[model samples]
Target: MSVWDDLVGQGPVVEQLSSAAEGTSGLAHAWLFTGPPGSGRVTAARSFAAALQCEETPRGCGHCASCHQVLQGTHADVAVVRPQGLSFGVGEARELVLSSASRPTGGRWQIVLFEEAERATERAANALLKAIEEPAPQTIWLLCTPSPEDLLVTIRSRCRQVMLRTPPTAAISEFLVQRDGVDRETAEVVARASQGHISRARSLATDAEEWRRRGAVVEIPRRLTGVASAVVAAEKLYQAVKAEAKARTTELDEAETSELRHALGENAKGRMPRGTVGALKDLEKRQKSRATRSERDAFDRRLLDLASYYRDVLRLQLGAGNDLFNVDLEPELRTAARNGRPEDTVRRLNAIMQCRERVAANVHPQIAFESLTLALRTG
Candidate 1:
C-alpha cells in the first residue's frame, strides 16, 4: 500500500502530488486543497506530507518510518493545525507562523497542514498570508478549505490548487468491503446513504447507532401529521442531535480542561493557583463555542437526511429514474409521493433549506426546526 491508498477516487490528485514528491514538475512551496465536506482534503494533504518525507523510493512507500510518522501525526517536521473553536484568531496564527518557520528537524521539508482554513479570522488569515508570501527555504504550507473563495485572493493566487471530487458510490462501497470487511449489501446501503461521503459511509456501515439515528430522521416526514406532532418531532430531533454532538465533544473538552489545570499547577485535590481561573474560563468559553458548532453541524446533517426523504418523494412524483438516497424507504416514499403533489414536495424542501440557513445564522435550533416541521406538515 502507498500513502495515497486511503484517498479513494482521487487518482489525478494522487498522481499530481506523487510527481511533486518525486521532484518532478508542478512542485510548489504552498498548496491549497479545496473540496466539499468529506472529500478528503486534509487526508490528501497529510498523504502528500508523508510522501515528501518518505525514505523509500517512489516517495510514498506506506511502510517507511517517515511515512508512518507523518500519517500518524508524530513527525517532528509536520504540524497539523485544527482549529478547536468557531474561529482561529491572530494569536494562534502568529504561533503557527513561528512554528512553521523553523527548519526541518529530519532533513526534509517543514510541512504545515492547516485544516478548515476557512475558519481563520481576517487578522489570522492576513498573518497566514504573510507567512505564505515570505518563504522559509525548507517550509511548505498545505491549506484545506471548501472553496478557493474562502481565502484571500492573494493567498489563492500564490498556491497551487488541488481540487478533490466526491467519490462515486461504487468506489466507496467497494472500499468499505475491501478495507473494513463490511458485508456487501450493508456496504452498498451505507454507500448510497452517504451520498459520496467516504467517512460518513464508513461510519454508517460500522456504527449501528448512526444507522438508527438516520432511521429516526428519515421517519420524521411520516410522523408530521398535525401541528402537535410536528412540534414534538422537531423537539425530539433537536434533542437527539444535540445529545450526539455533546457525546462527541465531552471527552475532548474534559481532556483539554484537565491538561490545562495540570499545566496551571493543579494539585492532587484539583486546586489551581491564583489567576488560573481566568485561563480556565477562557478555555471553557472556547469549549462552549466548539460544542455549539458541533450541535449545529449535527442538526444540519439531520436536515439533509430529511431533505433526501423529500427529494425521493419528489423523484417518485415526477417519475424520475434516478436512484433514491433513502433506498430502504422507497415504499414509504412512494406513499408520500402518491399523497402529495410535486409542488408540495418542492416547497417542503425549500423549507428545510431555509431552516438550515437559519440555524447556520445562529437562530435557536428548536425554533428553526419547529418552523420547518410545521411547513413540512402543511405541505
Candidate 2:
C-alpha cells in the first residue's frame, strides 16, 4: 500500500506527514508521534522515513528503491526499536543510541524511531535523551508513545510532537475496501469493531480465530443465567486468563532465566553479589507485573467486544436499523431490543463500565466478570 493509504481516517496527520516528507519546513529531526492505540503513529513515522529515504527523482515516490527499503524496515540508516519485553530497558536504549550515532550511507538522514517509547524505563529514556540532544547532523530521532504525559518532560520538550487523532469509522471502512480488497460488509464490521485502531482492525478482519473468540465473549452475557452459570463462567474466564498468563509468563520467565544463567553460569562457586541478586529479583517482579498486565489487557479486549454487542442491542432497541456489526447476534439483539427498555440499555452500559473499572482496580477477573454478567442479565 502507498504511504498515505495506511493512515486511514487521519487526514490532518496524513497532510502534515506528507508535507514533512515533501521537505516542508526542513523536516524536524526529533518528532514525537502520539495517539490512541489504533492511531497510525508507527505507520506515519515509517511513511515519513520512507519519503525521506526515497531516491526517486520526485522523492517520496513510494515505489522508489529507498522508499521501499525504508518501508520494509531494511534501510541501513533507519533503526526502529519495538519492545520485546514489556518495557524497553536501558540496555536496548543504549544499543539504539549507539546505532543512531553512525551516519547515513545515503545523502539523506540517519533515522531512529522508537515505536512505543512509553514502554521505555526511566533510565532508558534518559539514555534516549542524551542521543537526541547530541544527534548527529544527519540523524533524526522519532519517538512515538501514547501521549506527551508518557515521556519525561525533558524528552517531550526537546522533541517536535505530532499528535494523531482517531480515524473516522467511514474512513477506515473505505480504506479497507479500497486497499485490501476486503468486501464492504466485512470492512465495516472490522472498522467499527476496531474503534479506530488500524492494526486491530486489520487483525479482526483477517484473523478467523479472533472473530470466533469475539463471538464467544459476546455469548457470555446471555449464558450467565444462574448461580451455577456464574460459577462456570467464572471458572472458564479464569482458565482463559490463566492460560494466557501462563503462555506469556513462560516465555518471559524462560528468557530472563536464561539471561540470569548466562550472567552467572554454573562455573560460579562463590555466592552471587547482593546487588546482582537484587537486580535479578527486580527483573522477576517486573516480568510478573507485565504478565499480569498482558492478561488483563487481553481480558479487557474481550470485555470491549462484549460491550460492542450490548451497544448493538441498544442500537436495535433504538430502531437504528439492520447493519449491526455483530452478525451472529442479530437474533439475540432483536430479542433483547424488543424486551428491554432504553433505561435497561443504559444500565447495561454502566454495568460494563463498572466491570472495566473493577478490573483496572485489581478485583479478580472472575468476580468482576461474573458480576457484570448478572447486571447484563437484567438489563
**Per-candidate TM-score against the hidden true structure:** 0.97, 0.79
Pick the TM-score winner: 1
Relative to the true structure, candidate 1 has a C-alpha RMSD (angstroms) of 1.3
For model 1, how does the per-residue alpha-carbon lDDT over 39-135 read when each residue is reduced to its tens digit?
Answer: 8999999999999999999999999999999999999999999988889999999999999989898848999999999999999999989889986
Best-fitting candidate, measured by lDDT?
1
- The candidate 2 region of ten consecutive residues with least summed lDDT is 265-274
CA error at residue 217 for candidate 2, angstroms: 0.7
- What local lDDT score does residue 261 receive in model 1, on the 0 to 100 scale? 95
Please provide, for model 2 over 1-379, each residue's C-alpha lDDT reduced to its tens digit, 9 standing for 90 to 100.
4655677777777777777777765677799999987888899889888877877644567887788888888888888887745678888788888889897887388998788889899999998898888788889988888899999998899888889998888888888888788899899888877767787778888888777766677788778778778668767866776685677578868887767856864346645655577777777877777787787778788777778887888888888846565765678888878877878888988898898889888898888977877777766
Model 2 regions lying over 4 Å from their true place: 241-294, 314-331, 337-364, 374-379
